[model samples]
Target: MKRRFLVAFLLLFFSYSLNIYAVEEEPSPPPNIGFSLNLLGPIFGIYSLGVSSFLTSRVQLGLNGTYFDTRSVDPKVTGWQTQVRMNYFFSPLYKSGFYIGIFGGFESVQIKNNSGRSDNYTDPIGGIIPGYRWSMTKKLDMLLGVMIGYMYGDIQISPELSFVYLL
Candidate 1:
């Protein structure tokens, strides 16, 4: 009798376990706004934040802020910068493959000169930014770019690298 009962219980458990009740749902696509962080800058004590939003398949708007310390540069300088950007993508292979952008912003920097004097300047800045963006995964992306800007009353070039998460 005990053997018979155990066999019956096992059969019933297996029958119920094999039945399907609910189906799993698929994940939704990524959102339009992507928030990013600069990994390269932090190694030298500059912290940066960036955001990009898709206006259309070919157009995107972006903004970036950098708060920097002297650890990054020779002769030791400290400053902050803010930029506003807009990009137009050209490559058809991927909507974000390559982009040309224009950016305008302001930056202030202070440096201590060898004469035991600290000099600071605030400059109006504008730049042409060209970049390439590639999807690392469906929801992740990487952007590599360069900016040529007028800052401190002079022309300057800066490199950019960012990891982004699509919202």
Candidate 2:
């Protein structure tokens, strides 16, 4: 009976020690808040800014806003957009690795023609985005993704490229 008890105690102690070591080996949790800017927005005549927060170790929620004017390109388009999103990261922590998300938003656009006539419209938009976020430095990350969904009764696909600063 004593031999059995000794063996059981040793096994339990070994298991507990392993658990403690495993916990110590884990990476530190990421920051809770991040600010993001769209890198391609300026080139396309759109300016955007966003904020995101970690809801859980693998989940994050974000809000973004954008304003655009394309008079230089053609169609003389001007618009503003706002969106909110929730993402589930496949990585062990937030703002890293592969992620899939859903977003819903609204946009208002105006187009002016050469004849000086203008058309204005507003629409609600929703989509699914798949992306990857990589660390650029200790506190910066770059995200690359695509949004696919419905807008103005039509299917739309848009590319996304952004940089995030974690705090």
Candidate 3:
């Protein structure tokens, strides 16, 4: 399944390259709020959602929500998180090309322990994310990113994928 997804993504990714060399016009990217998803978290049973807004060709700001609930795994667990993200794309236009960004927020997590005690906390979060953004059409924009940051004061890594409609 992962291979299929990667193949599909690459196909879509390359579909746009054919236009990079064609005649170019005005750069019109998303300037409004964009709804997105964190595709990498689900592999670990984490589900996340996010939203963002672009200020120009080089700046963007957004927020995300993440949740985890498992009953079939060894220990039952439940949790949620919220994060704020800001990014800068080095492209020559708004909402297109490679990017580097930062994020800070908080998370509320809970895990069922063998001692019958649930561990939980709401703590500050921070990270540095590097990614790419692009469009295959006028109405749809996509993002592929990886986040390496701190959560609960611990270093961690996260991969992400998002699709946002231009407004």
Model number with the top TM-score: 2
- Stretches of candidate 1 above 4 Å error? 1-30, 92-96, 113-117
lDDT of each: 0.70, 0.74, 0.69
Per-residue accuracy of model 3 over 7-72 as CA lDDT, tens digit each? 645654564464456454545654677777756557668788888887874577888888887655
Best by lDDT: 2
Better of 1 and 2 by TM-score: 2
Per-model RMSD to reference: 19.9, 14.3, 6.8
* Candidate numbers, best TM-score first, in rank order: 2, 1, 3
Root-mean-square deviation of Cα positions for candidate 2 versus the true structure, in angstroms: 14.3
> What does the lDDT come to for candidate 3?
0.69
Instruction: List the candidate 3 regions with Cα displacement exceeding 4 Å.
Output: 1-30, 39-44, 71-77, 94-96, 112-118
- Candidate 1 residue lDDT tens string, 1-167: 46744653464355334422323232333257878899888788778898988776556688988887865456456899888988765543133455567889888977665566677879878987666778687668777777777865577777778887777
Candidate 2: regions farther than 4 A off:
1-29, 94-96, 112-119
lDDT of 2 by residue, 32-98 (tens): 8999998877886889999998777667799999887876765577988899989765555432466
> Candidate 1: deviation at residue 20, Å?
48
